[model samples]
Target chain A: MKTEEMITRLAEGLRPVRRMPSPPVMLALWTLLAASVIGLAALVFGTREGLDRPMTRFDMMHSLAALLTALLAGLAAFELALPDRDRRWAWLPLPAIGLWLGTMGVGCVGELVRLGAEGIRFHVSWPCLQFIIGLGLPMAGLMLWLTRHAAWIRPGPVAGFGALSAAAFASIGLTLVHPTFGPLMVLAWHGVAVLAVTGLAALFGPRLAWRVPA
Target chain B: MSHAQPLCLMLAPGQVARDARDLRWSTLMAAAQEGDGAAYATLLAECLPFLRAICRARLRDAAEAEDAVQDALLTLHRVRHTYDPARPFRPWVAAIAERRALDRLRRRGRQVARETLLDDAAELGAEGEAEERLAACQLREAVGELPQAQRTALQLTKIEQLSLQEASARSGMSIGALKVATHRALHSLRRRLTGGAP
Candidate 1:
């Protein structure tokens, strides 16, 4: 049809659409939902044994970093979801990720320094994998649903940060209940789960996210 | 790639006036979000030239550019709820226009890759007069099956080579109606001939 006629038809069909929440508001809502879901997971799984034990300095640092990572990654995902947003904003979570990884790396070194090779004991942690996935799936679903419109323009980045946010938040919950066993164990199983989740989400995100209008 | 700049920058004559216009668009869009059809219509009508300029810039083919503009308009309508009144309207519309134009270019690229144009000499020398006649017969039948208004619009505009204004006057339809009818007729014919490719 002629452009003018198309415009007229569009105008004829005009109806008030509820505006999407601002990015910060969406992030807040997502955080609330994510917290509820993760709390439910923690409750179902039960907090780790020795829940009464005080956290070490390293443990507190690691947890704090994980929290920051989740929040920053979530913010980045929301920002990237805006069509006019600069893609460079995808790096907003980089520092948080670096800090989280850095703390984990330090913990690993400390464990090795204290216990030598024995501290690096590695075994498949099925429970850890299950917990991460269980906590992550719902959060990822929420992220994808929230940012589905933006996915049409920047699917990979949006999905990557979204998955990272979910995975990082899941890690925080996993840490609360799952025994560190050793820093290496946490890195081996928990880290792998996070990577696996992010990789899988980014890979399939376009299909799982909303398709562009035909 | 060079044409990938923001449409407002490329089309707007002066920054100050453009900013004022942008503010007006945002206000109209806000009103549109509240279901004011007049505001929505004015906003869209004002945006047409800018959208056209951007699409035409991205797509060298005039027909393709027009199609892209329509696609962008449809997309804008669908995603109207996503707009924030706090943000400038130009970028939102520009981004959609650019994306639609790029989509058209990509589709054209894929088509070009898959198709090889036949030489005029080869087509003329082919021994396929019977097949051509059959195709023409099928096309005529498809045209005949169109709604009366569309058939007349198509015949006046495409077959009889009349301008849209001439066709509108002849058919006793408004220019907009004539254009819509002709577009529908062509789209219908394409679908029938291409088995729903259109």
Candidate 2:
């Protein structure tokens, strides 16, 4: 082909793809997500072991678990709806950070309410590890997931930025539980998770092409 | 290879005679990369006639001639990143342009097959005779520059030998809507030829 004509065709011939999902679909997804969180919260709050005994500390710990579960479920479902973006951003840090923050906030609040007169005590024991798993994991996972090894958004970079963004958001939740865990642990965990999530996001986020025309 | 050659194997008499600007391989590439519209215009203007001749000699339709060139250009821009800075540009561009033109021809044939299936109509597969093909090229030489879409629709369906359905699919035109594209190509071809012949 003539180079000029060929060039002209390229400039002139291209057409935009237009098959993006509608707003109603987005609203529906959001609504379903909200309902799931509420339902799980109710389920956690409603179950009182022997009807009046008010349940043990271990059993009453369902509130944090339920919140984490709801966040996970909602993110997983929404990830599936994003086309071409596919499975890339679906995994790791995004929902994990949010869930972790939520878990910490709810768990600390519930613990305080339960042990009113005595208040809650901190120990670096196995349950302390449980505290980490329920609260710490989300923040840590989110941070690591967001930041890449090099921490840049250059093309072909594999780190997902959204995960980092999630971690940053989740920090608020983590700080809420700081009274039970000290400033040192909160700062440490929050620091690691935020850096990780942000780095990953910088590396991988731009590849999403969220608004590709068909 | 250290040297670059125009590999079309079929250049016509006046095809190279007209639209002769920035004919040297390096100059055109530099112009194109630098976003000089005039240089681009010259580069395309020089190449269109020969490319059209190839389309005409093969396809037997004025419309397809323009499309072959248009598609080739679009392919050129899309894959521009692949061009080697150290090499002569013509050969690289020619290879892409030729492949794109052939692809358009094939896609056009596919579309015709599909449209025929839908209507239970016999598809127009241009059969026999050298004169018809040459005439088609002559017609294309005159009026190949209209809208890119129209050029593409015509080239794929006619010269490249795609059926309407297949052409429609690649072009993102519905089977029902392709007739408009066909009309536009032919009408422009007629107007250009009446005023002056290429």
On DockQ, the candidate that comes out on top is: 1
Candidate 1 structure quality by residue, lDDT tens digits, A1-214: 4678767767775778889888889889988988898788778878888768898887788888888988889989888877666668888899999998888888889889998885466789998898887778667877888888765466788888898999989988998788877677777777888898888888888677745321
Model 2 preserves the real interface contacts to a fraction of: 0.08
lDDT tens digits by residue: candidate 1, B143-173: 8899999998988889767557545534558
| Shift of residue A116 alpha carbon in model 1, Å | 2.8
Compare the candidates by TM-score and give the number of the best one.
Answer: 1
Candidate 1 residue pairs in backbone clash: none
Model 2, runs deviating above 4 Å: A1-214, B1-23, B115-198
Task: List each candidate's DockQ score.
Answer: 0.37, 0.04
Compute the lDDT for candidate 1: 0.81
